[model samples]
Target: MTGTRDRLAAQLEQWANRAHAARIAAPRRRPMPAGFLRGVSYAMTNRVDSSYASPRSFETLRALAKRDVNSISIMPFAFSRTASDPEIGFIHRNPSGETDEGTVLAVVHARQVGMSAMLKPQIWLGGGAFVGEIAMDREEDWKEWFADYRRFIVHNAVVAEAGQAELFCVGTELSKTEIRDGQWRSVIAAVRLATGAPLLYASNWAAGAVRVPFWDALDAIGVDFYDPLSANPLASDAELVLGARRAYAPLARLASTHRKPVVFTEAGYPPVRGAWLTPHEEPMDRPLDPEHAGRAIAAVFAALEREPGWKGVYWWKVFSDGQPAAPGSRDHNILGRAAERVVASAYARIARAVAGAPAR
Candidate 1:
């Protein structure tokens, strides 16, 4: 067992080294405008067994807000009950071990606990559920499928109406489905009618370019920037920063041409080695390395600061509590790992920069 573990470590070290060497040849850095900073905590739902929200989630968000986070994004998908069952008000188990029904009730609980701000809630759709092989083969069958999907979205709209969410995402990471015959516009129209809040759609990094067709129908460009960092394990902050810039240059250019504010719907660095992977795979377990996570997060903040037109960023997670999906797995993330603290501190710096200044 020891030998196997050592071999895995050696392979990872080699991968990290190659990643670092490539970063050395990356381009020069650019400084971000000092006062243009925004912070947000991306609240997790229950898709992953280990993920959950707690009173502390709100507390941490409140603390982070003290550093000038003007908004909060919540997921109303898996956390809330099914749309067919109106009586099932809040389906989520709160930190206190109580299940609440209705999305409005959940938000009310959050508010009572002092999570005040412009609440931005996201409703996920457009993945395998929306465009699986079965549905693709029966193109004529979309009308009924869309009708049901629209109904589910309407439930989210009801929650938005009750919570008064400042922003709402109509869908997430549904690239293949989004490109289908005007489906994006139809979904947007239905959601817009259901709720008057500003609308945005989130696409994975691989699907961002092809999903441009739907961008015109929405209010902002939301993307999850979680591309695997291919670099040396020992790469310095400067190298990471340069490497991040090269990776995101295309996104900056896209925002410029589209004239839309870019929102990083989800982004974070795991505190353990080899935890990062492509979107198709599940997150892996590794020991938390606070220093490495902190450095990587700092590098991302530096990169975003240098680039323009980035409206805000939401870390991939905040808090969780529950049994691990698998025994002895660290993938069930909760609490502030090294990366979370690094992000918090960067947020503090941005808040300080804008403190007492006039709002833009």
Candidate 2:
């Protein structure tokens, strides 16, 4: 036990030093104020050069704006070889939309279309592994991973600052690393130096949001909330709404304890039958059912829309090309689906009341 503690301590110490240096290298800038964040996650494709900010992309933002969506979380992803492999960086032949220039372009265009942008750089591991499962078995590997992640985050922080993004997400769903509380704080500090954009960390819906020791350091509590609202596919809307409240009851308590706003960094149901039974997965052989998706979202809104600490939800995703999703898609797109109508209804209320910001 003593040996384990010593190795962990040493690992943290080495990582913290490198993180501090990264922070020092970022340019200074004043952060813009935060906003209501009623929006959807943007970018479903690995777009090539300049495509994310083309005139068609601007039209996409215009479409969302017309639907009462006031913001979008731009998901720019970097890849790691495997969950356990610690080398986190952009690939040489990365998609342009994931590059620094692409992120800045998306941010600029979102602003032009009267929408706020949250620059969220996510890590995609090989084999389609869940990011929350990322872990390092060796002390040296952990140390190297943390050092590399600091660089990844700081570099993107510079991009977020350059684009004047309204919000910046440091890390998302890397729960296995959340145990290193002190080192995570150092990483956040490094991001602060690199960008003045208000910081938020996206936590896994199950545990990270409740247990992360450094929530006090961020501007808001962010959770990629895919918690199942009901196990029964035939459950009525009332039952689902009850389930939603029960699931969020503890989360609401967490917000009360932190006295910070709670935002759904990501949340959406696939337009599939029984999706509410498994909000995070698209089970095989399930028929596409847009009505169920709409019901699930409406239930969530009924449960949390007026909750004091509730700020907003960024719906799981929409296509980046300004093109409509395929009508028969099983993916979590709300565009032109029944869920899209539910979103417009909920977001309209947010635009008229919560944000109080007039449309462009």
Candidate 3:
């Protein structure tokens, strides 16, 4: 897991480095199309072959639509042994359970239900290493990692093109690699060559978003927001809402600076005690506390729903089979939790507002 200091350091470095101009080569920036996405992440199961194509997967999509969700982020994962292994790709014939064929099926199902899909290809690191720790000590190692990464991401873009995804996310939450402007430019270029779909590289919240130098090369700003709403685990409702407002205040400036919509590609608080204190991590010992989780997520919606330059948000995960990955160790799913009601209500309100008002 990424410690507070490590995450802060990455963010601060990006801020300081901004004074020095980054020389990146790419086509002129194009504006993203008009729309807001109310999305939920649908993850593929590693053990279940053709999981995304299952009837349960389609059922999950319908369930989300009932909650007023208008979009879904389809997740198919790649793997690496450790942070610096320089070997990044599929572990076998079907890496992370769902294949390109499965992803296409998921997208087709989502479209059948009148919801747009964002094909998001992400990396799942082994050895308990964080994606932010994916750095190499040698230049050759970095080169090797990027070489394989380019192929991996380009393959995903091809998948997105086939799926006809509403949006295509090149990568997710890989903070350490955000500084490789030249390498990333090449990767983005490859994806562009492969597909005409819109692209985004989802950044980790706050500092991670700041670290990504290639946001200008992409369509919209994608952020996986797990920023702490309060250091206090037992923060009051007002305190929680205040924390969320303060956390998102800077993003308004981020939107203006980039001249693009800021989308929360991932957002959620684990249904566990003190999740508000470190919204990103899933601690092993915290007891389940649906009340705390519901309040924390409601605060985020309360803060961002009316904020300017905010395009949309995708809740940070709901599995296809519709359950937590595990009870304690991986209980981030909102289904069967109090947070589900909060999300349903919030998304419903968003829908009403969008339907009744002028284009944002």
* Per-model TM against the reference: 0.69, 0.88, 0.87
Residue-by-residue lDDT tens digits, candidate 1, 90-135: 2344633222233444355445544432234333323423311223
65-139 in candidate 3: lDDT tens per residue? 888888889987789989878988763256347778788989999999989888888888996678877888799
lDDT of 2 by residue, 1-360 (tens): 999999999999999998877734545544434446788999746556235656667778889999988789987778898988989877523554466766788899888888888888889888888998899999999999999999888888888888988889899999999989988999999898888787888888834578888999888888898888988988999999998998788779888898887888899998888778888887768988889989999999999887878777899878777655686778887788888899999888866774555321
Give the Cα lDDT of each candidate.
0.55, 0.82, 0.81
Q: Which stretches of candidate 2 lie over 4 Å from their true place?
A: 1-35, 92-95, 355-360
Q: In terms of lDDT, which candidate is strongest? A: 2
Summing lDDT over every window of 10 consecutive residues in candidate 3, give the lowest-scoring window.
24-33
Q: Superposing every Cα of model 1 onto the true structure, what RMSD results?
A: 19.2
Show model 3 residue runs off by greater than 4 Å: 1-34, 47-50, 91-96, 324-330, 356-359
**Top candidate by TM-score:** 2
Q: What is the Cα-based lDDT of residue 328 in candidate 3?
A: 49
Which of the two candidates, 2 or 3, achieves a greater TM-score against the reference? 2
Off by over 4 Å in 1: 1-69, 78-102, 105-135, 206-210, 274-288, 320-329, 332-334, 356-360
